[model samples]
Target: MRRLAALVSLLLLPLLLPTPAQAAATPLQVYGAWHCGDDACIWGNVRSTTDFDAKNHWLIDRGDGRPSVNVVVLSFVHPVKLLHKTTDAQTLDGVPRGMTADIVNYFAGRGIRVMLSIGGITYTTAWNSALAENAAQFGRNAAEVAQRLGVGIEIDYEENSKPDLVGLQAFIDAYRSVLPYDPSGANPAARLTIDLAAGDRWLIDIGRKATADWLRTDTPVLDYANAMVPARQPSSSDAIANWQEHLDGKPTYSPPIPPLAPAKFTGAFYIAEGNKVRAECADFTASLQKSTGSFVQTAAPKGAGLTPGMLGYMFWAAERPSTKGVTTTPPNSCEGGVGGGATAYAIPIPMPALRQS
Candidate 1:
């Protein structure tokens, strides 16, 4: 009788143990910042090494010989020009003059990953036109740029109201055809990703489609999605609420949107807000990154994902997001906020292997 009772207890012990999601959380794999210039997301001019490094040194060496983030995304490559394969004195092989190899090498040399963003809010019409014209070709062109630069590509098509989902799919397919998904993270060009709105409310169609089909862990399409920041900086509670929406999808929609895996995306915050240095860029303790750190690390999976916590954090506009906004340059660098956060999080440089599920 005693032996039988012990056997029963031993069998039930497995059930009592915490599931993977409830277990100890893992550190964030991705910590990135998007780079933009004063020219409204366009790096228009080719800058010399000295000039470029002077303004951007803070990114590479965050006060203590460490980088602020593991990755840097160069913002706003013209989709129309890339689609048309346009080239001129200002553009080379459909890439901007400013997005040169030297610039990419600057970061890559320092154990940082670099990516090129293909669209922004200002290029909504352009994205529509390009998708309408030749999305497959556009994807091929983007793949070509990625190959040439040895960098990854980010699809930032912010067509909230009427996104060209079909075209976007074709674009993704074509790009994947050229550079297939690489789980090993060896091929940089294979590291494709997309940008989603802060919450499931906006970018409804794209978000619905992305969450349902593209971002599935069983059969992944893009590497991941970025939950971009809202118009203004959101408080810790507001930001978590927004992130929670992605974890808990809307079921009442036409074809119910599914919950995204916590490992499949990163939450974004504003580094600076129009001439004002945000806490994310200036002060770590007061920053949303610090306030929301625990939630970001241990939030359990809702309906999808076996892992706890979202992928990691991403900061908005590294250099100068806008002409009017405070630039993340020199005296106003993100060493305190972003850098301190990096140290606090012990963010792995060159971005270690990410959790697939």
Candidate 2:
């Protein structure tokens, strides 16, 4: 009887242990900021388009194979205009200035998810009045951009000194209103997500309050929230600690902030850590998960090398190497160059479709 039980236990152990291939093929959303620049004229490989090309090329190599890294989100930046009412938007003709359909198509063909991120910390002022004064038009413009790009949308609204939750929600609501239920021509489930500042406790408070009502009513307001981890170690710890504390304690309003319950929700709580540039990402993810047990993805500027347990990454700067800081570029490279040669791994599950009930 003991021998028979041991044989049965051995059979179950293999089934329980997750293999690297299985882990690398889940829904990991890795993103990189891409740019259109004049650098292709020199160093051939160092050209501005190299990073963008290399990204897609990387996918071709990994397609249906044992893709250690899957699901790429390419952020197109540069002379690209996010605003609809601006003179450039009005004057520019033929698919809006700087938006190349060919480039967008290049990514989509590879089964990668490309998102147009509007209003980073640098250009956040664009929303100051747009959100406060006129939210309706903001939505219209955002939808139009999504339509033109044929990709999903993202709002990276990161303002620390003057974080306004009301204004932020207003902008998100406005954008949600205009977007069609199925914006992706190919994937109807694709929708918009907001990258909230992790450092701001006030912002988190407002988001939870808003999400409670939004979730109950089933408004297409917010699909997922990306919590931005600070650049330094202490900052990352503080961000996670405060968020966990808020979720775990206190009852200021109805429907208290939701704790990191793996059973109830699978929302993402991510942080950006230096790749090979710094060895803290693996440890950072481990500590945060220990605290909340939420899904985590390590955010790295474009070239940071891979870390263990990384769901995906968000690289800084659309333009790098040739284009320079026109966009915030990631420093460390797995491929060992500015052209993005670093190879990372993650599970490649198709992005869950957002259902509008």
Clashes (backbone N, CA, C under 3 Å), per candidate, total: 2, 18
**Deviating ranges (above 4 Å) for candidate 2:** 1-51, 54-81, 84-99, 161-170, 180-190, 199-206, 214-220, 233-332, 335-346, 349-357
lDDT of 2 by residue, 265-347 (tens): 12222222322232221232333333332323322211111221223333332223234322222232222211221133233
lDDT for position 52 in model 2 = 57
lDDT of each: 0.90, 0.41
Residues 198-256, model 1: lDDT tens digits: 98888899999888888888998889999999999999999999999999988887777
Residue range with the least summed lDDT across 10 consecutive positions in model 2:
260-269
Task: TM-score each candidate.
Answer: 0.92, 0.57
Model 2, position 346: C-alpha lDDT score: 35
| TM-score, cand. 1 vs. native | 0.92
| Model 2 CA RMSD to the hidden true structure, in angstroms | 10.0
